[model samples]
Target: MSAIIRTENLTYTYSPDTPFEKTAVNDVCLEVEDGELVGIIGHTGSGKSTLIQHLNGLIRPTSGRVIIDGQDIWEKGVNLRDIRFKVGIVFQYPEYQIFEETVFKDIAYGPKNMGLDEKQVGERVRETAALIGLDSALLEKSPFELSGGQKRRVAIAGVMAMRPKVLILDEPTAGLDPGGREQVLEEIREYHRRSGSTVLLVSHSMEDVARFATKILVMNHGSVFCYDTPPNVFMRADEIAEMGLSVPQITRVFSLLRKKGIDIRGDVYTVDFALKTINEYIASKGSAREDGHD
Candidate 1:
């Protein structure tokens, strides 16, 4: 329930003082509570990537501060190595980063770098592999031999093996089939539930975020548009669209019904919720008709 990740007036610029200079992230203040799964969404170039880069200590903010686990990451003598270990980032197409011959070794790489012994690394790798739904039989096979989704799970498990306190995933499910996407996201949800570590998922899929995230962080024009629960964020359907991001398709449908003078709740953000709402509405109307007959 405490804040594990906090950014105070965080700002970043590219090509500073040059003709190509531009602010990518500006005065962004944000907080992510420990063990919370947060979905970060925005239009292209809305600073989602840059902002998260700061959290992983991969980029220095032009100004402001990035505080992780109650310590300013940039403060004097604050070790960046330690910060990176605390915040593990799995980038898009992380499969390309895989180099080890075996899936087990790929997953063991991080723990090994952390100076873990052979026995410890093996234990960590197997535990993380199982956590991500990778089979024990597949651990010995080459990472290249796995399916796209399996490769992704292996790469993600590689990061998880380090036992980071905060995990940041950038476009984690990108390019996967719908089934693959669902499997990966569900595994991520399970990982968060079992590990009790905070997760920041940077994704463009409104439905994915709506389905899995405890809270949503909407970014716009390099600023914090809003940070709230799924229902609260999706309720601003029109405003979100105006920012070049669509609400979940179901949310849009409910919004359209409201605009057409139908009495419908505007907070529908998932297919399952939409179905429930529709059934409830029909039942209510039926009840009214029965009352009239009585």
Candidate 2:
């Protein structure tokens, strides 16, 4: 299948032609296949946010091209606004963008901007609100009056109401408690599953990315460091650590266990996989003991 989005040697520089100018992205080429969940990780100022912004034409690359669905998003006369509707971006603390009086209105904002009919806007709002686990009764209440988590949901629902083919979330779970983080991540996963939309999650949490992302992209020094599956990327734990990043906690634990001569696999990044491996090891040990007795 063709990539939903592709970049050709994409490069971006901030404050070009000025003494303080610096390149934020450099010769980075990547692709996002349709309906795939891609995780983006990097230290601060690694250009992750800048790169994603180019996906939907929010930032025009200083050089190279960003193509969405086989067309250059920055082509002259291309409707960038329409592109945004198809490629929704939920920024960090998106709730702060909420300006509507009611939760329903806040959620409906995107579709309304798209000139959707009243009935369609209302339907989209309610459907997306439900998807984000927003209570129906709360839809009538002022968004400003809702709790932090609820307001965050309203912001996410606003993006969902646009029915984007690709959703890019920058730290979608930021500033939330553990439970709230899980809630938001689960909701985002469900939305991706139900809609089959491509998801680009930019997060600093290795654990969350390992749990949810199908592919991982690691960036450093404003360039692509690696692009692969979680296990493949996390396998270079020491290198990742040196770069001011970390592998998932389970991966780290298994790595330590292997170092301690426990015969455990170091590549296991998820809790389920770790448990299965440990169980198989125990079973093997039990069989060895029985044979010794025999």
Q: Who wins the lDDT comparison?
A: 1
Q: After TM-score superposition, what is the CA distance of residue 15 in candidate 2 from its true location, in Å? A: 1.5
RMSD of each: 1.6, 1.9
Task: Tell me the deviation in Å of residue 104 in model 2.
Answer: 1.3
lDDT of 2: 0.90
Using TM-score, give the best candidate's number.
1
Model 2 clash number: 0
Error of 2 at 217 (Å): 1.3
Cα deviation of 193, candidate 2, in Å: 0.8
Error of 1 at 141 (Å): 2.3
Model 2: per-residue Cα lDDT over 202-276, one tens digit each: 999888898989999999988999989887887777678789887787888888887788986666888998899
Weakest lDDT window of 10 consecutive positions for candidate 1: 241-250
User: For each predicted model, how many residue pairs clash, with residues at least 3 apart or on different chains?
Assistant: 0, 0
